[model samples]
Target: MRILIAQINPVVGNLKENKRKILEGIHAARENGCSLAVFPELALTGYPPEDILLLPQFIDEVKKELKEIAGATQGIAAIVGLPRANAKPFGKPLLNSAAVLFEGKILGFQDKTLLPSYDVFDEMRYFDRAEERRVFLLFGKKIAITICEDIWQHAALSKDVSYPLDPVAEYANQNIDLLINLSASPFSQMKAERRIHVVQKAAKTLKVPALLCNQVGGQDSLIFDGYSVVCDAGGRLVRLGNGFQEDYMVWDSEVKADELVAAFDKTEETYKALILGLKDYFGKQGFKKAVIGLSGGIDSALVACIAVEALGKENVLGVSMPSRYSSEGSVKDAVDLAEALGIELRHVPIEEPFQSFLDILSPEFKGKEPDVTEENIQARVRGVILMALSNKLGHIVLSTGNKSELAMGYSTLYGDLCGGLSVINDLTKRQVYQISRWINRERDIIPVSSLEKAPSAELRPNQKDSDSLPDYEIIDTVLEAYVHDHQSPDLIAKNHGYPKELVCDLIRRIHRSEYKRRQSPPGLRVTDRAFSIGRRFPIVQGWV
Candidate 1:
């Protein structure tokens, strides 16, 4: 049997568009002489519809679109993920379900067995668990279908959660010919490799070919990397779809295919993921132009490069807002970088606004010496200038704060943190340098001076980041252990041979900055633990 894996990008809550895409996939399947076409989880209404699933009228519309899609499946069979209303009326209002359509009507539904509730997932709040496992006999082939989290039970990716019942185990000894999964899994650093292990394990256990169709495109902070995969019955990969974009692959069970290698390396994969995320964020939101503050720093330079790549250089505006404390070389670097990218650079001096603020606050601080407050005023002045341009022009601002700065509370709230979206808020300082170097491997698109300079805010004279926080290497290592890995500060200190006092102090700063992050713009999530979406902390907690 030939099966079509349709990896599609669906806008959340756009029912008509999603239905059109599903019908398009179904027609393609029939035209290609394929027996079955599979779509990603929640393909109809889009993944994680969130509160949209709570609307009764939304569910009614979904039923309407689903039936129209079912009508188009005359010559082919299709498995589509959607929200199905619960008839029992005792548990939740809807079931995270997959509709199996064949001929001209609904064949059956395989409800999702496991509903993840941790991290970025809150399916337990909306979806009810499946009542039973099912195996369908189609075209003389017995196929067992599972949702995204159903197959994930085998891998046990999370230590805090475990399911008592295994969905794949229930399909064992059934002599199934194929196992198919519908997934809308989000992208992380190594999540794609981990997903392969899960699929391979399932294929080996069932002794049948396994296939997964995943969602593509970005929705808010989440970027879905659609590397839909297929493995043989012996647990070996035979087909791999495209990453960070929509793709379709037809797999023939009788024919043997060559194994495919991973498409991009770690840094390149991350670069592409950010590009896709930024592109979809603007594309889906009807945003046509972007404006970024170019401070001649690595973080801002990287964000500018990514903005130019996502929204064309013509669509990106780089503004250099230099203050009195800003060095001439830093300003020149910003101009050179903009010239290299072929984008319009606007020079807006913040000295006027900074002096105005200082004059106004002079009486309020008559006896007080110029301190961090004066430095913060410079940042807020720049923030106001950027926001003004953003208001007058139709371009959305892209913030340049990286994860490391945001972690240590080094950023000024309502100042450096001002933007419509945070492009690199999940990437650490080390990652920022790494991706910038990768961008300049062939040529120096980003200025070499910007890459090699000491990291600074430039709000004060000779204000190096090292004066306030640890070295970038040390800060990144400590953050990887404390923030990402959830390791204790003492353990991190012991493992890295760092001072225990310094490690504890850094963790405290992270804890104290919860309120600032809460007000920051939503950033693209390239890592598993991002500040705004996945990781939640109490602003008033005393755990530290």
Candidate 2:
């Protein structure tokens, strides 16, 4: 028997487009004479419809689409994921479900047993837990179908953490011939290895061929890298599909066993993931062009470079929004950087807007001198101009704030935070510099002056970031410890050789600014935890 895995990228809520893709995948698999084909989790409505799942009309539309797909499934057996309605009182009436279709009929269905609740997921808020597991016979083999999180329970990371029962294990005991898992698993650095290890271990223990079909493409903050694979009973990889792309791979029982041991290209995998993420976010958000505020800083330079790489330079507009606070060398550097990157450079002086805001606000102050408030006004004024241009030209503005500034509340809300997408919001200040250097090393697109210039927001007269915040090296260390490591203030201070009070103060600012991040735009996920949806903190809360 031939089994095909169709790892595909589907647009969320675009029923017509997603259906077209699924039909194409099914046709491709059928042409190869495959008996069964598997698609990723929520393949019908895309990975996450988010709150769109709440609309009754949307659910009805999904059911209609599912029926349409079922009618098209003649002669070929397929398993596809979608949301199913469970009309019970006093709870969310939906289940993350998979349906088996064959010969123009719905054979059976299974609900996702595990609903991930942490880190960019609130599945518990939307879906009820499935109560049972079952296996279906097809092509003389019993197949156990599971959703993304369902199979993950067997390899759950924490032993102390109580979780739902392992559905795959129960099915394994039921003498299944194949274990099929559908997923919309998002990308994180080195996460692919963990996934492969889990699947391999499961295949070895269960003594059955395991197939994983993952979704590809970016959906808001999540980027699903589709590195789907098939592993034999001995835990040997049999077939590997492309990562960061829509691909269909067929595994036959007759092919030589040694041919399946080929490895995936790691560097190309990560590069494609980043590119696909940037492309889909820009494309799906209905932005024909992207306007980035290029300050000749490493962060902005890196973001501009990535923007150009993702959306051609013709679609990318670079603006050097300079102020009196901006150094002359930095102004030259911004112009030079734009020329080197082949992006259009426009100089917009914020001196007029800065003076206008200061004049309006000065009368209300009773002899109080200028401070960060005045600095923030400059940032906000520049923000207003970018937004205005964005509105005038129908371009989406991209903010360049990195994770370090975001973590310490160093960024001004409604100022630098005004953008349709925050490209590097997940990267720390240090990683921003590192990626900048890497981009320059790989391709000499970024100007050297951008790397050499002192980091500054240029929001005030003779302002430097070091004046208010610690140097990036020190600040990023403190940030990583407190944010990603989730270390206590005392532990962070002891580990990083900083005063406990200082660490405590940094954590306090991060908590206080939860309201700001909550309103910020979706950003790319280059880290394990990013600011947007992944990291959740109560906006109205106090430190104990």
Q: Which candidate should be chosen as best, given lDDT against the real structure?
A: 1
Cα lDDT of model 2 by residue, 1-544, tens digit: 6878889999999989988888888898899999888889999999789999999999999999888888888889889889989867757789999999998888989889888887777898889988788788888888888898877778875332347488767876788888889999898766776777667877887898888999999998888988897888888887777877789989876455663554544444544566678889978877669998888788888888878888988988988878888888788877887888799989898888888887888889759987889888878887888899999999899998888888778888898999998888888877776667767776667777778777888777777888888778877887788777788888888887888887787778788878888877788886677887678788987562
Cα lDDT of model 1 overall?
0.91
**Cα lDDT of model 1 by residue, 171-258, tens digit:** 9988889999999999988788888888989998888999989999999999999999899999898998889998878989989888
Error of 2 at 129 (Å): 2.3
Candidate 1: segments with Cα more than 4 A from true spot: none
Clashing pairs for predicted structure model 1, backbone only: none
lDDT of 2 at 283: 84
User: What TM-score would every model get versus the actual structure?
Assistant: 0.99, 0.94
Which 10-residue window of candidate 2 scores lowest in summed lDDT? 259-268
Off by over 4 Å in 2: 87-91, 158-161, 259-274
Locate the minimum summed-lDDT window of 10 residues in model 1.
Answer: 257-266
Report clashes for each candidate as comma-separated counts.
0, 0
Best by TM-score: 1
